[model samples]
Target: MPIKESRMTQSQNVQLLAVKAQQALMAALRSGQLRDGQFLSMSQLVTMLGLPLSAVREAVKHASSLGLLVTMPKRGIQVMEARPETIRDCLDFRMVLDQEGARRRIANDDLTGLGALRDRHQAFREAALRGETGNTPDGPIEVDLSLHDFLAAGLGNAQLAAAYAANRMRTAIIQNARPFLQDRIISAMEEHLAIMDALERHDADAATGAIRLHYTQTLRWWGVT
Candidate 1:
């Protein structure tokens, strides 16, 4: 069956299409379908995403602005190599924003969103414990990103939320570098559970502590700290 278009404005349609294309490209890149050093032309992206050329162009521009892709004059767009310095900078920025978000969440006495985050964390933990690989390699990465996104949304800061969304590719790239292990995954889940507990208790001190510890461990995984 053919899909029918909704009654959305042209701009709204473009934005929605761009978002879909961006997500599709990110998924491909994370799964190794679009490998590092592989250059993709606009035509290729259009075909891959089944999107309009304009939508693909806009998505490419957005990704490039986010530092996920680099364009060469004649060579087209290639995935940027995951560099340590870039990863460190991204982690530092994310940590600062996330810590602020946690602090605010605690101060505001918000625990509603924390439950969902905890649930996802527990699911990932159980999957890791059973030595079961997720349906996709990006599964754990998506969970980790969701935790931060939930916090950012709870914080109610538009700017921080935008920044966090912009860094999605960088987060994926960093997570992709780490080896998936049961023990490591379990530890990460425990860390997330601790943070969620703190949030649930509205304990700013404990939440901040957990965030610091989690980031430290994550950096270690990337050989950064």
Candidate 2:
């Protein structure tokens, strides 16, 4: 039993390493340590992050899947250009989904169950004030995908939620491919809080408007507008 437990723990540790590797890579991309048209070598990554080669490979695979990184035979992993159309499409998709999500949540009177959401936003704000990157768990590449995930899934419409999640993942990668300015981040945080407040009040129009504002501000930040 002890041996089995030890193996399980080792497996967990490997998974954790992979997660950390992805987070580290995201932070690097966000900080411009990696950029579009830049080439990445696995050996270099392993040395840089002090992680096992296999774990770095796991991270590379994920970034490739997101279309943020690609392998060219001679060039290894090269960062892909995040095209303007790509960013615009992502923003457009999110605006539609989030607007609809707000409508459904408000119509269904979901405020009672939003306590957890409220707590999460509050915690994140407090963490920000404390000079901690409270969102490190998901990495900077993705700005709170779970928050949008919650909105998408909140209405209990499985199909809508699935589509939103798919787009959200892609959108997040593009957003995180470049560095975000502090002012833009603060504006987004406020927009999110406003959306949450509107949702809690069951004000569909207000919530929808806030959602649009959030996406518009985000797109503007990404130079989509």
Number of the top candidate by TM-score?
1
TM-score of each candidate structure, all chains considered together: 0.80, 0.62
| Top lDDT prediction, candidate number | 1
Error of 2 at 75 (Å): 8.2
Q: 26-102 in candidate 1: lDDT tens per residue?
A: 77766666665567886887888788888777778877888888877766788767677877888878887778888
Which lDDT value does model 1 have at 109? 81
Model 1 scores a C-alpha lDDT of: 0.76
Can you write out model 2's per-residue Cα lDDT over 1-225, one digit (the tens) per residue?
699999999999999999999888766665556765677677876787788888888988987776767877765777766788878887788788878877887887766556776666656555555657544334323445545766777667777766675566556557657655444445656777888898888888998898888877777777776
lDDT of 1 at 63: 79
**Residue pairs in collision within model 1:** none
